[model samples]
Target: MKVPFNSKDREVCIIGLGYVGLTLAVVMAEAGFKVTGVERNNHINDLVNSGKAHFLEIGLDARLEQQVKNGNLKSVISIDEVESASVYIITVGTPLVNNSKTTNLEAIKLVSEGVAKRLKADDIVILRSTVKIGVSRNVVKPLLDEAGVEYKLAFCPERTLEGKALAELVSLPQVVGGLDDASTMRASDIFGFLTPTIIRVTTLETAEIIKLINNTQRDLMFAFANEIAGYCDVVGISAREVINSANIGYPRSSLALPGPVGGPCLEKDPYILSEGIKALKGNPALALLGRTVNEELPKVTIENIQLLLDKKVTSQEKLKFTIAGLAFKGRPETSDLRGTLAIPIIDEIKRILPNVEIFGYDPACSNEEISSLGITPCGNLEDVFKDSSVLLFQNNNPAFEKLNLNSLSRLMRQNGIIYDLWSQFDGTSLELSNGVRYGGHGLMYLYNK
Candidate 1:
């Protein structure tokens, strides 16, 4: 099979049209590449053909629809499309599963096998999937070698924020690396259309390591913030206020406050890296510690509830809990809940209070999605606020911040625990409420209503 690296529109084949894949495909097409999005599932293709997007990213669906109309983007199912592209980018999922510490990179592996089988000497297979440090070099390259295909391969991990992927694709500096010098140069040239600032790494392993380190470092920072927040709760100080005030002069030290560390990348990728390393080195510091701290957030969150409920709960009253916002992050309304941070918190809530009726609410997700997790979904914002003992803010949705404190107090069951996970609440208003307990990172303020 001849590699399609000819001059005709620099044909690009992107495998997997999930959140990352679909966004990257649209970005490439808009940048004047003839893009063919290949997905194993036909559902995504149907959505694309119908001018709809499966996931929510800012202006992504409209951009994709425009590209499709302009005759620059096309969708297909067969792996035979691999033979029709100059560059094949594998943008598949790498999710962490139950009973396994490591992530399942089966999609990446399958795509690599297909690419290796169809690759020619001058072809490039760019892996845009987030994987462990040595995956590209140790796993992918070996598969290519076994298939008797000589080609350039690069590890170019996607670091685009979900809501702002299109802008970030052009602005964010991309880290790319390949097996050889020629491979690295080719990968850099191919991605030049997406972003001008490209940092080329020496080895494939180094490039892969760059992706892992980015998430692991962020995880470490968040873990530190969460740990410090607990200490702030004991000391009777407002953590968010202190951090916000101190952030004025000490710019470098200020990072995002501790919230749910779910989402796809931060929760899963670090374990893949740490688990791979632990197999060889026995113990890793930041990666393992970060995972432990992040996983423990739900339990820690539930403990905060107990602290608030101290001497308040009587035998007669039943706790009515409401969870606000279920998306992994705020903006553009995505439905991908691979490594959801809210799950642990939900699990803890269920385990501790079996009698409590937990109701979850998200603007983006449906009842079917929440029901799959064994939880009942409250239809809307008003439904969640009506007569609840506690309101847990799992995600930082901007819509939740606009809520009326007085109106919410009326909906509560007297002395309700207002668990502000992202601390998106007014301290003054919370303090004014009678029998309302408001707690967030480092500062737990109880309102005697």
Candidate 2:
């Protein structure tokens, strides 16, 4: 028999001190548990040990600093560096492999192998990284079972937004699904430290699928809106007007607005869903379809831009282009660049305008980060638009809505185009002089609605 997790005194060892793991560690440490994080990256271990985070999140720095300084939290590069804990949380990255669209489970495999060697009777092991269904059973379980020790395993997905992870971690209902009934109760008891609402599903597979379904549903909704955008583009109608009017005072129709749909979850969850289904010889057309539509957005926008230039109103000579809102999203803004559509958009722009001067700006991302991605880091919104032939608003930052278009038009080259992918600004309301053109993703007709 093992110890019951009836109190916060149970020691915890969290693998992977990245975003998900680090936030969880801080929250749990603050919840009064002794927490140790294991990360392979030396730099990450140092940052955590020194009370700094690898990324930014509201209220994370202060809490992390307190935890490290107060001796409640510490991170190590290996599991062996610390004494065995009663609970283990695996929050490692399960990124997709290049070109395969299949999830790379090397991190999960390695972490599980390490944890298996350290397992004791009734030691709780929770998988928090998003993974394909049955991964907990088919892959991780077999590896851990090799140790021939009794342990509790569960899949408790970390389903929090990047920028708001700290706040959401304490509020969002923690979904717990375990290998068995005992496993479920124990994991549920563990996550109770984070949130009061512990949603216990039937099995580990149920928990895994819930995570995928949540993200995949979001991707599908956005894909539908983007499809509407494409349809409106072809018909020369306004998708924004159609969607807005349809949803206004209509309870049945809660349609999402058309916008650039790119983020870590939406970008890869669909493929992860498809990969899982394929192993069982099941075809997931809708899952893959959502991804296909969302993936086509960058290329489609580039094609539209090329058509604008082919009109010959804007001079191609000495042309300069700028992309603002380079983060994956603007609302719930984050500095994370993973799975951002900005990358594909940049690639498409380069293909059309090779050797063209391209600049990038994002309120959330640093100039050095922008420059590291091969884009010239732009300083201010005015400098981003000054003398620029084209400016693309690739995200939904509300700050873009406040631009003084009439004044900025004077600075833009004649017939300069401003394309807002999220249609953040009401272009129709702002009349542009100096031959400057304003447009957006869904249609040439830009509406604030």
Candidate 3:
């Protein structure tokens, strides 16, 4: 029998209250279901119960507070508090293992063991974490079966963007697959409350691969853009202008902009996809190559900066390099620094110019956090611009969008170089009084001059 969509008896227990899990829990609670969030981290559990979010997400705080006030949502450190729920959704992180490309299932295994202990007949169990292919069937299902409890198991991978989770959760079509027919129906019925569209697939592996391919394809598109940008650099052409003109009035061209492509999902998903392909004794040459191209972008950026420095600067020891914006992305806006390209860029710069003074600043990140990454964090934007010979805008933060170019230009030394990686400024028209040179990715006209 299919469970009713808005049945009051169907309580939800969302495991792992991270970005994916917390957003889903809040939305589910807002949809009029009693929700319990199970988290292993004490700090996260406390933050959720106190009506605050540990990380930044657009419109998450107010909704979370409302859900807490209405008694629709509660967070706990143990899964024992989740025993009463009719549906269990696992959204734990499945990061790559240390120094290896293999998918680490330790968190999933631990959560599965906990869920298995409390397994009850007819209870719906959904895996929403991004995982390697067959993880839902091979890794998660076996744990539940060993407990000798009857439950419906399904894989419904998370596909929402980090900053737009709540909005995308309701608007985007959810892909759901299950171990059996009844399991699929139960999983679909539960997610139906969040969104009207639920795409039902035949098996668990399909759902897992669907999410993997979604991100991997995106990674490949970005890699292609970056690759083209590199080629444009060699030929003295603007990649941005070329892409924009090509995409104009064209439905076939959906090219992404070239920049540092780093985040929790894009940086790691391709590797996971390639690993899955390798496990099946198949070659994932294209996927691996795409990952290589994206990963090498930071180094390419560093090399371009070095060329500018060698031509403009008289002494390398006096050069102060300032990097602005540390977050992975800035459009939707978030404080998440996981797999941020800024770190690698900084590391590569330090390797190339060991004596150059490097400073970093970001509106979303803290001084302590930046210091933890071995970057000397600036207290203010002026401090970053002061005495800086090279300013690199790494993140696409909105704060950087409304910048007073004249005021900032006045602060920097003469002939100071500005590398706008995201094309935040007009490379063709920027005329600073202090002779500050501005160049962006694919804007070879500025570099050629």
Each prediction's RMSD over C-alphas, in Å, is 3.2, 2.8, 2.1
Q: Candidate 1's residue-wise lDDT over 116-195, tens digit each?
A: 77777677888888887678877878877766757788889898877788889889998889889988999888788778
Q: What is the Å distance of residue 377 in model 1 from its true position?
A: 2.1
lDDT of each: 0.77, 0.85, 0.86
Poorly placed runs, candidate 3 (over 4 Å): 1-9, 316-318
| lDDT minimum window of 10 residues, candidate 3 | 1-10
lDDT per residue for candidate 2 within 213-234, as digits (tens), equals: 8999999999999999888877
Q: What is the clash count of model 3?
A: 0
Q: Which of the two, 2 or 3, has more TM-score?
A: 3
Alpha-carbon shift of residue 249 in model 2 (angstroms):
1.3
Q: List the residue pairs that clash in candidate 1.
A: 415-435, 434-448, 434-449, 435-448, 435-449
lDDT minimum window of 10 residues, candidate 1? 1-10
Model 2 off-target regions past 4 Å?
1-9, 312-317, 446-449
Model 2 — which ten-residue stretch has the worst lDDT? 1-10
Ranking by TM-score: 3, 2, 1
Model 2, CA-based lDDT: 0.85
Superior by lDDT: candidate 1 or candidate 2: 2
